[model samples]
Target chain A: MKTFRILGRNIRDSFRGVWRNLSLSLASISCITITLIVVSIAMILSANVNNFTSQIEKDVTIVVFLDQNIEEDDIDSLYYDIDTIQYVESITFKGKDEIAGEMMEASETYDSIMSNWTHEDNPLQDTYLVKVTDIDHIAEVAKEIGYLENVSVVKYGEGMVEELVSIFDMIKNVTIVIVIALILVTAFLIANTIKITIDSRRREIEIMRLVGASNINIKIPFIFEGLVLGVIGSIIPIIITCYGYAALYTRLHGQLFSSIIKLIVPEPFMYNVSLLLLVIGMVVGMVGSLRAVKKYLKI
Target chain B: MDQIRVQGVTHTYKSGVTALYDLDLTVEKGEFVFIIGSTGCGKSTLGKLLYRELKPTKGTILVGGINVGKIPNRKVYKIRRKMGVVFQDYKLLDKLTVYENVAFALEIFGLPKDEIHEKVVKALELVGLKNKLKMYPRELSGGEQQRVAIARAIVNGPKLLICDEPTGNLDPKTSMEVMTVLDEINKLGTTILMVTHDINIVDKMKKRTVLLNAGRVLKDYAEGEYTK
Candidate 1:
């Protein structure tokens, strides 16, 4: 079709424009790359904090101690009661004798003193170790269990909970603010690039209009130009990030990524997902430039 | 039938004084008409109205039976495709070769490549620029550049070709040469409407001359001579 030929001509023209305005094109791309890099870092840190917190929460368990004199029926009834609560993920019933024996085995700490106390003479109380559906609701759950009949004490990992939560909140806020600022910067930079390019070609655009070139035809080349610049910019950041992460990961864990500290122990998938920030950066650059051309060209 | 009509047209700039006032004129099909006026007169404004570039603050202009003033904004592009426009400045795309400039209009119409190449070659050859097909606009002499512009305009074989002071910036000898080409193109039956202040050139043609003074048609003379 004739439209195909025109599109081809415009593509070639746009390619030529990128080279002709070398300094402006470079400036625009650099602005985009820097903005993307900052955005990518924010993304990486956000993932890091999320992974770190979830790991801590999944590892920590709530321990609820019951009175030693509690009957088997009362224990079973309490178990059923706690099981029905929405947040109670799963519960493990540890008899006092089982707890004291496990404690003695864990203590290379006080083996001689701890071994002197037999399972029959165990001072450790019977406890229900509870896991929650999510870490954030642990305090409310602990309070509920503490008030239950026959429950002597309910211990939530309060200090760890506070630390993980504050870190998670901080990571989220910082990531959002940084990403917003970077996106705004990218948009401003790309818009100025398009505006400058259009300014230089004002005479040509007007003449094209004179010859009955529709606004759509006049702008296709410039939009293509912006796309080319954005794509190039995106590649630069990706290469640098790939190399940076590759090297850091090598020093930290393998050729692909340090998968484990020990050969047998595997790293989490979070590391792989973190590398996706580079892809996020690329998409950001591409979309940012496209938006710039769209806003100004207005076909 | 009149291929072009202007009725009660008046134009005033932001300065609040009329440039053209209550002008009325018509040109039949295949007519070669010249509009002549002094510097302060509305010769250029009338040319713009004919092409629908500047709408008269009050009046109506019709070209090829289309009421240009009442044309909807979206359809303006369709109306323009039916006409060729040339300017004294030549307005050539400096970046494009002479051949590409001529082909631009057909390309805008999304004509097939084979058709564009065939027509572009024909148009350039008609304007006597076939040898300079690869030459950029900046490389050509002023007269030659204007010829390229002419080549571009007629490439589409538009129903109406409106030229505003097509020779204003040229030397006397070059001006006459361009006029000869305009005359030659006219003989082929594409109606030519030219606006000029060049009374010397106007007197030499003496075809259908419409004399515009302060926006009104002061005279309409067939086989008309240049007049004060």
Candidate 2:
């Protein structure tokens, strides 16, 4: 019961402090809001970029075209051979006639040019559509599959896949660095703002100290004030990021990146990001105020 | 028994200036003692030492039979809780009402709401400012504000109240009013160690006086003894 009363008093004093130093409090809130917004936008962008990269990775498949003159009976052994290789997930065999028919159905130019060609005269070779367990190992799997008997070519857009993976890696690294730097900067700014508040109330704090207020009693309200500032600061950004991301996702769905690259659906993405922002805000606020109040709490 | 015992206490500031040297004094329980000295004569330093604000460089100060210098930092507040301190500037939170300012001391102890209210009103009533409960410090005169500070210091019912130049910022008339309040509080059996430069109050009141000069006691006089 006594603890509850102290906590209530701390909370009341915190709000009163906030109200008393309205301008400084607002300045701190704005700083937190702006910093969090930048962080949230970075988070949303990285989530979408991650979604797009993984999709691209999933779509990557090795195409193994067989020799045009290969024996019909040799295909079964070839399928068994490809299946045994490590990293080979699945392989689908397509005959030359099926390949030619797919080409004819895909375009009118191909249909007109291939209407007179029979399966015996088809220029297309038999092929295997091979999926690898991991996109990172796609190039190695393609190279290994090329050594198979009667295989003429193994193509999986190795250069494009490698570039895409490297680009995503760079983006991930840069995002981490940027996010960490922003968090530190935010903590520093909040700490300085709280330091100003402590400075302004030095006399009151001195009186409290002289009158026998414990160190914990003196520190609790300032910490509470910091937490309140952080929470208030995070609210605006959370609202902005959640609704802004949802809006961006809605307006640009399938229109900008198309099927090749896509934004993550907003439901779970925004929810997780919002939660992260709130946690960071609260933790930063607490830590900043805790640090700033230490120098003045010598009494 | 002595409520406070200073045994050869000496204090030296970090600037290499000696504020008090080999000073020994004692005040019995419920005694009202006046510490008189000119500026820079270590009067405030004695008041500070009594509250354990400045640990004596040479000897120990035992307050209520506990060695104040040997008390750990975490328990300093406990020792201070047994003593109230009033300052020259009133030190009232300008934004807080006279009532809130007085209640702040007990509030820090997490006293119950009704108890705080009752004690705050009682303390203010003693200071003759119960009618100015809702007024802010800025709204009150200098003397009234000092009374509120007094109310705050006494609200917790501290056994010893240390006032360091409590009237240094007020006029002579207001200073007398403030002194009268302190006198009334002292009559209620709270030991008071007041540091003052006002010779007029010192000579008029004729309480027990400890005169300090150059960080040492120049004279120790009994009740009704004037320094003139």
Candidate 3:
């Protein structure tokens, strides 16, 4: 019962402290707001980049062209050899006639040019479409398949896939670093603002000590006040993260620039980001207040 | 019973200046004693030591039978809660009203709200500031502020009340008004150890007086016998 009363008093005092030091409290809140906004943007960017990378990994496939004169028995042996390599997820073989038929269906020009070509005169090569388990090891898998008997050429957009993946990886890493740095900066900024508030109330703290207030009693209100400021500071960022991301996802039609580079769906993603913003605000606020209290207040 | 017992108490500041040299003193419960001396005579230092604000470099001091010097800094509030202290500057919280200032003392202890309200009102009434409960410290005069400080000090019903020049910032007339409140409280059975350099109050109160010179007890006077 007594503990509850003390907690109740501390909570009440925390609110009163914020109101009494409105300008200082607002300074702290605004600091948290601006930094958390940046942090939310970084988180969204990182999440979307990860989404785009995974989509690319899922869609990319290696195309292995067989020698035009290879015998059916040799083609079957080459397909079995390619399947034995590690990281080879699945492979589908397309006969030359089937390839020619696909080309004819794709365009009127191809249909007119290929209508007169019989199977004997057709020059298109039979190909194997290979998918790999890991995109990072796609090049190695393609090389192993190229070494197979009767294989003429191997292609999986070689250099372009590697470069795109590397760039996406860099973007994800930078965004993470940016998010962490912003949280630290917000904590430091709140600490200084709370320090000034504590400095202004030095005499009040002295009187409290003289009047028999324990150190815990003196510290709890200030810490709670910091927590309150942080939570308030995060409100705007959370709102922006939830609504802005959903709105952007809608405006961009679920993709950026093209359908190949897709955005994360808004459903649970925005809610998760909002939760993250709130937690960051709360933890940063408490840490900042604790630092100010420990360093500045003698008690 | 002795409310405060100091034996061979010596206090040396961190700057190497010795404030008190082997001082010994005692005040019985329900007794009112005045500690008077010239400036730099360590009268305020003694008051601070009694309240455990400054630990003696060498010696034992007991307040309400607790070894105050042995209590660690974190547990200092346990000893502080058993006694009250009034400062020369009044030290009323600027943000709190007279009623809230008095209520703050009880609030720190987590007393029930109704009990706090009752005690705050009674404490204010005793100090003759019941009508000014809503006034902030800045709105009050010197005497009223001091009375509010007194009310806060005694609100917890501490056995010992240490006043370190409660009237240092007041005029003579206001000083007497504040002194009257202390006298009334002392008569009601609270032990008071007041540190003051006010010659006029010392000459008039005629209570038990202890005079200090160079941090040593120069003279001790019984009630109705204190002289300049």
Top model by TM-score, which number?
A: 2
Native contacts conserved, per model: 0.46, 0.63, 0.65
Model 1 regions more than 4 Å off: A2-6, A94-98, A114-119, A254-299
RMSD of every candidate to native, in Å, equals 3.9, 2.7, 2.9
* Every candidate's lDDT: 0.77, 0.88, 0.89
**Per-chain TM-score, chain A, candidate 2:** 0.84
What clash pairs does model 2 have? none
What ranking emerges by TM-score with the best candidate at the front? 2, 3, 1
- Interface DockQ per candidate: 0.51, 0.64, 0.66
Error of 2 at A283 (Å): 1.9
B-chain TM-score, every candidate? 0.96, 0.98, 0.98
- The runs of at least 3 residues in candidate 3 whose Cα sits more than 4 Å from the true structure, single-residue gaps closed, are A65-101, A112-134, A145-153, A296-299
| Per-residue C-alpha lDDT of model 1 across residues B45-97, encoded as one tens digit per residue | 88988887777888889899999987754456677788889999999887779
Write out the backbone clash pairs for model 1: A253-A258
A31-94 in candidate 2: lDDT tens per residue? 8899889889877777676777677777788999999999888888899999998988899998
Across all models, the iRMS values in order are 2.6, 1.5, 1.4
